[model samples]
Target: MSKPLRVGVAGLGVVGASLARLLQRQSEALASRTGRAIVVTAVSARDRARDRGLDLNGVAFFDDPRALAGSESIDVFVELMGGADGPAYDSVKAALNSGKPVVTANKALIAKHGLELARLAEEKGLAFAFESSVAGGVPIIKTLREGLAGNSIRRIYGILNGTCNYILSKMETDGLSFEECLKEAQRLGYAEADPTFDVGGFDTAHKLAILASLAFGTAIDAEAIHVEGIETITQDDLAAADELGFRIKLLGVAERTARGVEQRVHPTMVAKSTAIAQVMGVLNAVTIDADAVGELTLVGPGAGGDATASAVAADIVDIARGVAIQPFGRPAHMLEEVERIPMQRHEGGYYVRLMVVDRPGAMAAIATRMGERKISLESIMQKGGARLARRRTDPPPAEGAPETVRVVLITHATSEQAIREALDLALADGVVTQKPQVIRIERE
Candidate 1:
């Protein structure tokens, strides 16, 4: 047998430690399959004294990740550091510069700097593997980069973040408010105290940007994506969506259109009966539309130590087996410049909620504005009658006084411009008591 492949691990966090344990347990089987033994020669983390419960006696320790990267004892560098920049970036760059293969689970770094890293790795002819970066353990990256190489992908989308999905799912299932569910998630350790990155849709946007590049053979462009969070979605909106045969999901969607590529992360209204809507809790699911392979949906655990480590180990095994492929499924130099489509030009249906004065001409004024803008309404529902039904309630509105009404309208597929125009007209005419709440709808 040939000499074993010595690997250095940086960041002994949950993922890094899990990867070390996996490598330790699976080394024998991995060796038999690859005809080369795999060993972890060194490890690095912030604290060397922390009891990680893993045997590190055989492995050398380094205080700085760059030192581990530059160490001559390892042939591969596994980066499980959890940041887009800083030491993770510095270490990965050092490893690539050292001509060692790299495997990283850092989605942010990969999403923000994947194109440049791919270029450097390609120029040096080194394996730049990040199978755990997108959708955690789903293996979607490999599925896109190699399995579907022959086909052209038209669109890809999924529930990419588990924290956001879990909160949203709890809100829908238990009728909990966003704040309440977020607090529960925090108490349960599903979310951090400051959960803006995951809850605000930035995390999903990062992963989507990476997937978009692989699917479209384009350069990584996180800034090009239009992102919207689920903070504003109320229990009323969820109930309304469910009543309309839909579920509100935070979705990362990328599609290749004639105008350009549409990359967006937002709270989307997906048909309730579709598979994507059925995905609940902290689970992740990705759907790909390809020319030859048709539609493929992959769903699984998207985060945590072992699950993510499983993907990282898979990439290490691939490297051990001598499987070297293009980072983005094409030569880095061949990646095309993606034409980013503007979000305003996106065509879709919308759900609008308006608190309107229940006077005789109020609905007429709102309808006229929508008609002028060519936004045809598919359905309208009036709520807030329960208060009026109570005999103990205050006296009804005087003859000329306007009563309040909750009006919900679902519009047919229309351009965003039409909706904006209609909203502006309605607000100007004082037909809407409050600013109209508009939520975009995605057809499954």
Candidate 2:
């Protein structure tokens, strides 16, 4: 009865179309639940003739999303358009500038321009929610903003990229190579034709930047966060992780450290017993550590139109119920520019796999390099093997390039700088045949 909570949607791609269908199909139930009928009055897409599998009869359509954003018929604008800039940014900005509540699933947009947008939304006294941006349906933003509002959030971390998770999960379970699993993921639509964005860790970085802002009350700094992709994760790494009773996952971690706010996205080896370690395939799991909550882990579908739309729809319902909250869990101005802690100061256990020229004193030299810096090794594994397939085009390994041995070391907690220096020394000393394959360990 409250004016039907009028809605406008931009970008009628898979997610937009799904959201349109969902609103129509669940109209009655949503009305009863929220005590306000939710209706899709305006929709925007590039193609007007293309069938969206929905009857848009009696609804307004706009070729340009910015026009729909400025329409007076809709009270709320939902943006599913992807990209860090361009139409998505312009449309959302227009909607917020006009004092309309905007809900968007654009992680890149939020990560890159969240501070400016949040400031504008606060100034206009309107809602600028992005629950669907990070970890899809996990409701992580809500948890940090509402559930843990009473406590000091110490850290937030999780497996944020489902594509990388699927690839890694397949590699671990099926004993398949990264290439094989990646191709299969592409066939299954879990990965894009150009899987660079997902596998390269930029996608995770975008999501992490948003979360870091919400959790730590810092300005979103996607560029400052250290990003490491999963492309370097080999089958041997997976096998080694399994042998050590651990699972490898690509995690985006943000924490309030002594130095400042530290955000990073990289391949992490979590112990088998951890809750996040069990999340496999396309599922995402996020853990928030706070003073009051201790550790709360949220697990669910990380992507897909339906799952993400569920989150978007929830924000709509909250708006209908007149719920108010900050876009980043605090006033945009109050979210100060916290100093960013560089990854060099990051302290953590590490899993290192080095190809050594199986000769005497090689192992001792590695040990000495670590010992010089007082870096303690938890365990050492030696697997006898032949020369790794050193590229088909390259000449044979110098006839007798010293039969290589695989030495895997699990180090106790140490600074990233110390480990890097030790590894560099080992490589320079010619004790290592190639660069070491290092995966940071996350016991929690």
Candidate 3:
């Protein structure tokens, strides 16, 4: 067997500790599989005194992660430090400059600085692996970078964030409001106190950016992703989705279009019969649409100490086995600049929920507005009477004023421009009482 692959891990958090334990426990099996003994030789973290319950007996500890990254003792650097810049970025760069193979689970770092890092790795002919950066433990990265290499991928979409998924699934299953589910998620440790990063759709946007780059061989353009959170999703919308034979999920979608590659993270209405719709709770799912594979979905735990560590281990094993695949499936210079398709030009069916005054002319006015834009409606259903009006955030009706009712319209395939124009016209016509809820529908 070749010399043992010495590993230095920075950041002894949940994933870091889990990875150490896994490397220790699976050392023999991994060695037999990879033709090299993989060993953890050094580690760095903020609080060395913190009891992570891992035996770092023979491992050296570094006060500075950069020092560990550039250490002569380790052949590989595993960065579990979570950040797009600062230490995570600095340490990873240090390791690459020191001619070490790199593995990471930091999505933010990869999404933001992937190109630069990939260029460095490519120039050095070293592997830069980040299998755990997106959907944890699902191996979507390997599936895209290797398994589906022979096919032309048409689309890739998934429930990429577990915190958001947990909240959404909780809301749908228990009929709780968004806030209630969020609080529950926090209590369950699925969400942080400041949940904006995850709940506000930025987290999924980061993951989606990475996936889009791999699936399309495009440069990672996170800023180009059209993002929307599940903050506005309500029980009314969920109920309406059920009636329409659909389920609401926070999805990050990247696909080919005539204009360009379209990447979006939003609350989407997917048909219940689809594989993605069946994923619930904190589990993550990614569906790839390719010419050869047709449609494929991979579902598993999106986040957890063990699951993410498993992915990190897989990347380390590949490195140990002397696999040198490009970070984004293609050579860094070969990655094409993504032609970003604007959301307004997006073509899709839509679910438009309007809270309109309970009057005869209101429905007609809305229909006319849609008709003016040539938007075809699949169905128009009024949900409940005046007593069932008013959204959670809607102020109570003024005394003696006309009450409101929810009018949901499912439109046939149309451009986003047309839908926005129609909704704006309806609002101007004094038909829509509150801001309308418009969710893009994914038929598959």
Model 1: per-residue lDDT, tens digit, 344-393?
88888999987787678888899999999888999998875535522343
Look at candidate 1 and tell me the lDDT of residue 125. 90
Ranking by TM-score: 3, 2, 1
lDDT, residue 369, model 3 = 89
Candidate 2 overall Cα lDDT vs. reference? 0.90
Residue pairs clashing in model 2 are: none
Whole-model lDDT, candidate 3?
A: 0.94
TM-scores of all predicted structures: 0.95, 0.97, 0.98
Candidates sorted on lDDT, descending: 3, 2, 1
Give one clash count per candidate, in the order shown.
0, 0, 0
Name the best candidate (by TM-score): 3
Q: Rate the local accuracy (lDDT) of all candidates.
A: 0.89, 0.90, 0.94
- Candidate 3 lDDT over residue span 99-183, tens digit each: 9999999999999999999999999999999999998889999999999999999999999999998998999899999999999
Give lDDT tens digits, candidate 2, residues 68-122: 8998999999999899899999999999888799999999999889899989989
